[model samples]
Target: NNFSKSQSNFMDTMLVFSSGTDIRNLRQISAEIESKKGALVENQYRLRKSEVELRRKMRDFNNMKDDAESDPFDVEIMEIEIQEAINSRNGARTYIEAALKTILCMKQQYDAILKNKGIEDVTEIDFENEEEEFHIKKSTQQAFEDIVASGRISVGNNRYLLQIGIMPNLVHDYWIKFLGSPNSYEKKKFDEAREALYQQLKGSAIKEANTRGLDELFYENSCVRIEHRK
Candidate 1:
């Protein structure tokens, strides 16, 4: 009977040790997951920054291409910057993918530990759509119409103004008309003039729209339309 109790005690002690070890491993893995998520967020930021820079550089290059005063060396530098930004953005995407894989493996291990312990496994999820509250009052609708009428586009945390890729008739009718002019010399002048006005609106119309209360959802959709126009 004494030998039996001893054996049972030994088994119970081993079980406790195993449980403790598993818990410690879970804590370690959780820490690693948190670290990896932070890295993923950083990479996302880098990707956006790189994309915005590349887009700006390309626009600048296009606008300056026909300018008599624009230097070839400067254009070459812009091309190099754009290429470097592309490489950096691609590297950020690769890092994010690798980080996701590592985190996924760690999560699987964590889940396995939960199953072994007979503990309920809980998973947390976040949705981008849930990030912002959508408010669509009548005034907000009015503001959205105001923005649409103005042909203005804006985005970012504080709603900084950005240029629409495709110019509306309200904004660039003259450019379209000039491009289609019958006189070859007029078309040539229009081409060489570098029509810098077509690039983007100078200021955010969002603030003006905000007076009537801009519909956040509509604003987001409008921004999407502006982004995909070209």
Candidate 2:
């Protein structure tokens, strides 16, 4: 009987121990499940965020595609307009250059005529004696006055006139002196200086032409060859 009673007490103690172990295992399983649920929720949130960003990018790309399709000729039209502007600029430049060349030729002819008439200095010429022959016409003077009053003598359309107007009288005096120089040494010095200036201008023009990728043959054909008088 005592052995039977002892065995029953030992069995009761073992059952309580087993019950405590089962409770601890259950708590651990519940904690693990809660942790897994939290991780799944976070992953789902990240996935939704990525999906939203992808949709936004796709929408932007579609909008850009629609815009491009709506105006397929936009780029071509811009190119044509740019080409037209370049052509217009080139035409204006050519016109201005021609006008300047004409003016320079006229001035050279006038200087030659004066030199032939034994006029060394235009400023020293007796204007009173030749007033009837070379006086400015009233109509011409009035037109000049009107143009000045209208402020039309600008660098754009009247660039040649502006250049002539801005040049000092001393320039003409110096040219006259150089031309009437008695010594061959002075004439040679002036010729050398003029040649140097021409070379500098030619170099600048060549540099500009090269930068624009102009055809060498076309540039050479367009250039006026200078003939230096011996």
Candidate 3:
């Protein structure tokens, strides 16, 4: 029962950090999107205003050209003004299109992150409560010990454990403790340990998927071999 409790606590702690970090990221991205949208609207307005000015300039040039008494120099200046207006309008239009593309890409990212978090709406996020809930009360050393005791570091679960649980929650200090003293040798050891864990987990997950007939859903390149038992 104690082991189970320790595992539960470790997972809860990891989840708090993971979920809270994602929500915070979503909020930051939302703010950026709104700011960009405002700029896009301003640019659009400028483009429209430029179009009106261009039309008015063209009309002025036409009227000046028809006036026989009008100075030749003045008519030439009007033509130059109309050309400048056309350039300005074109630039504004190009900028607006590019801004629109950027916003579309950002929105796609926002949606992807939202789906990963299993949240439908950004409006539902409560930042104040999220911070309070994710605040870790335990010291780094204690948390590390809890992780070691969790017994969740086995095959088929490292994908979640490493990617979602440990990587998000652990800092440099935690890694130093985890992988041993900082040195080239230690780094090599760390890499080897990680790769070994990944291979074990991948194989396990693939086997489980095959047994459940969910291989295609989970993996695109998994090879299934028919075992002939004689």
Candidate 4:
């Protein structure tokens, strides 16, 4: 149950985080590398909040410890010492709860986005007419060109995206099956793709990791975009 639940949550997180950047950087670009959603955003916030709590607690704790050293038998020092731990624990619990809630909220949001985006089958997707796109180098395009191109794909310049040559569901399932952990494996595979890409692009100017998930396919320089059929 834990494995299945974890896998499901991992997929959910992937989709949720894939919604793109925060409000500050909302414009779609072709250079995005990682997909966003769960641990990426949620863990980041949780870390920041926890850091603040920890710093505040440590400062207060250190001050109390100093006071205790000055008055070794002070009863108030003992009380303060206990309270400091309690405060830290309380802060951590609050952050944990908030992080969990944020994930739950993202789950709801992603599901809604899928429905709204008309992603009938999360597997087969067409890049044109789709707002999101994941760009890749011309090499990755060969695999895609053979299978997905079908006269429906377009190639562009500065192409250095690790696109979803296969749909998210397929990619998601494959990672979980092979590596036994979706989150960790997906990131690992992404890294692998980078290694492969680097070798492929040797002597070539390093291009950005450009990608924007779309509901359909379209054209832009050498970037190849393909459309999925119903």
TM-score of each: 0.44, 0.27, 0.52, 0.29
Error of 1 at 23 (Å): 0.2
Tens-place lDDT per residue, model 4, 1-230, is: 23212335455446524433222112221112123334346546655765676677667656766774656555456566557656655655554555455455555554565566665423212333233222333333343343333422233311222333333333223323433435334656655653454344442222221334342243453364567699
Runs in model 4 lying further than 4 Å from the true structure: 1-74, 119-133, 136-230
Please provide, for model 1 over 67-109, each residue's C-alpha lDDT reduced to its tens digit, 9 standing for 90 to 100: 8899999989988888988898777777777777766766777
List per-prediction Cα lDDT, in the order shown.
0.51, 0.39, 0.56, 0.42
Ten residues in sequence with the least summed lDDT for candidate 2:
131-140
The list of candidate 1 runs beyond 4 A from truth reads 1-20, 121-230
RMSD of each: 31.3, 46.2, 18.8, 19.0
Q: Model 1 — TM-score against the truth?
A: 0.44
Candidate 1 CA-lDDT value: 0.51
Which candidate leads in lDDT?
3
Candidate 3 RMSD to the real structure: 18.8
Question: How would you encode candidate 3's per-residue C-alpha lDDT over 1-230 as one tens digit per residue?
Answer: 23211123234234422332566656766776798789889989999999999999999899999999999999999999999999999888877776666566667767877898787865432553343223221222233344456623333333333332233233333444554654325546655544443333334333444566664322222333548798
Model 3: how far is 71 from its true place, Å? 1.3
lDDT of 2 by residue, 83-143 (tens): 5555554444444444344334434444554566665533212332232212112112222
Candidate 3 regions with alpha-carbon error over 4 angstroms: 1-20, 132-175, 178-230
Ranked by TM-score, the better of candidates 3 and 4 is 3
